[model samples]
Target: MAERPVTDRGEVGGASAAHASRGDAARRLWARPAIAVAAIYIAARLVTTVFVAVGAAISNSRTGGAETIGSLLMRWDGQWYWVVGVEGYPSELPLDAAGNVTQNAWAFLPVYPAITRAVSFLFAGQYPIAAIAVAVVAGYGASLALYHLLRERIDRSAALWAVAFFAAGPLAALFQMGYAESLFLLWLHLALLVLVRRRFGWLYLLIPLMGYTRPGILAFALLLALYGICRWFRRRVDPLPAVQIVHIVLLGLLAAAVGFSWPLIAGVVTGDPSAYMETELSWRRGWTGDHGGFVPFEGFIQASAIWFRVWGMPEAWGYVALGILVVALIALLVFEPHVRRLGVEIRLWSAIYLIYLLLVFFPQSSIFRLLMPLSPLYGALALPRSRAWRIGVLAVGLLGQWWWIDQMLVQGTTFWQIP
Candidate 1:
């Protein structure tokens, strides 16, 4: 058109330069994997924070009590952790009128509370603040570790998507809670990362950390055993060295020892040979009504019957459903193409950990939280390249997060609502 003014041309040039600078900054931010993962983690945490705040607000309004976010974070099992941190495990177990062991600190491991106690000193000994801080920081570390772990087996885009799914999943609220799950997950993800990289030496340190942090080190031990067998079978192609063999054997033994050490420590301290086992069984009694001694693979079976009866179904149906679930899981691990792509080590770890849970864990409201360790499976779900599919799953996760927070944290007045 008309002749453009020189001043207008200069203004348009300046605007274009600014826009280009902003675009370059955006590209640079996404280029660093760590920074990008951190951004996703932080965004997820913010959404979880909103959920927690809403839960607390709703809880307080209903109860007419002072239910702040910190207090809500420290609810349920969080209180047990606080007890462990403040009072330490009792030398003599608490007993009911029937002389059965009641729920006590021995049911929880020491590392999480120990670290929380140390961190609390920085905040004038506020356990909730310390606990949440530890959980949030550990969760951030776990997200980074998970991304790196996935990157070992997948493309960068898939790895990042996996991390996003993990961070924003239904149990995302755990990442900011006063519970031990997030810290344990950080150790677990790091252990898995080293395992995938074939850096067996690092497991020397990680195994002990995992053993102390949670009750799943036995599963890691089993993973090492299976991994060793796999390596031996493939030695011709993979070139399994003698040093790696030693590392695998010793690590497996170390994990087993540490896995059983907690029970021994509890036994020695409380002067009861089955102190830890009894303490765990104490929780199961609430549902099963004073069960017998601990037996492998019994809890799930017992819980299934109890749950089925409660659901107005025949108890036999629970066994049938449980069998079907076991078969479906096995089929997925053995045949699912996406899961196979996650590599053998991940599959081994998942299988072993699920076995561990089926062996000891009583199915209850807490089962969802216990399943957090299997989160690497999110990689499989992230493998599909459809953006709409990914976004749909993410939306479901966010909705699930809200529902879990509302039921388990906000309207947690009933026994079944426990988180």
Candidate 2:
């Protein structure tokens, strides 16, 4: 018999393939570099949480609103999630036909305190403690997920830094309480990891559920479209066709349809979505007299402007800075070194999806957590050379994001109330 080359049946190729698939997970778990990144942040969060708890215990007092960063974590969105997890929804005061309510779960309950309640059910003693614990743990897992995903594409060290930023970054405050971002980030990491596998069919199925969770999913779905186009472009001659555009369209439609139904239900009952909006907007606007509720685009702009002023800006100047950052991001992506490597068709699709977010949707609801997906979107196109640079940039970003959210939740009063 002639000598023959070993095939996959010889075990090497099979094992290599298996190794490629599971390599990042194993390495990320055991690797010293990754553990070091995760550990520093883990210890930092542990110390901060203990400090906050001890401070609360020693003072025998608590401050609500934006006075202290810790208190901001304890209240606002934290209070809302705690309420839902502990009490569930009460039918006695169902949301109005416009989908507005005393506790408007429709506006933001897709990512509620379900995890907190489930964890609490385990011990049933200190729910507040349990809720906080869930937030901290979920935040940690989210860091691991982010690290693992980046590690799959980049180096192990790069992934470690990415995970470290996720864990102990200024945005750490979000996890210190029962906020949606705490849970939302964990789910997002899993979703994005699945996306990297080029599993559009699975993405289409899962994105709708995510869409139901937060308004931010609208932006996320759009980013997915951009990534899809990028993938399709990179392999045109030897094209990879497993992923398709139909999933993006279907996911968009599903998100739009499901989210729209909530408002439509109110329109059916109250004559317009603005009816529920009138109340919510009025409260948020701090109106002593009759003022209208959020009218979608108009309301978003108006309320966000007022909020910018509250953040110590003169008149929505933060929006201008935000615009500049976005512009820089677009310039970087459209002109990445791989632009030619990615076919024109793929590039075009990516542009369409990303531009749609900038032009139509994001400004309409440019909340921080709503824009969290942008971090990944930016990360996708950003080919960072220096690990130190990546760490430094993300450190600044995390701080700025924390300040923005802190101002929104802790400092500012309510704006446009739903009717």
Q: Say which candidate scores most in lDDT.
A: 1
- The TM-score of predicted model 1 comes to 0.96
> Number of the top candidate by TM-score?
1
TM-score of each: 0.96, 0.66
For residues 148-265, write the lDDT of model 2, one tens digit per residue.
5565566655556556555555456566776667566776666676666555566665565565544455555556556656656776664655435666567656655765565555
Task: Please list the Cα RMSD from the true structure of every candidate, rounded to 1 decimal place.
Answer: 1.8, 10.5
lDDT of 1 by residue, 1-419 (tens): 35567778889999999999999999999988889999999999999988889888888788898888887778899999999999998999999998989988998999999999999999999989999999999999999999999888888888888888899999999988889999999999999999999888888998898899888999999999999999999999999999999999999999999999999999999999999999999888888786589889889888887789889988777688788999999999999999999999899999988999999888888888899999999999999999998898888989999998998888877767788
The superposed Cα distance between candidate 2 and the true structure at residue 284, in angstroms, equals 3.9
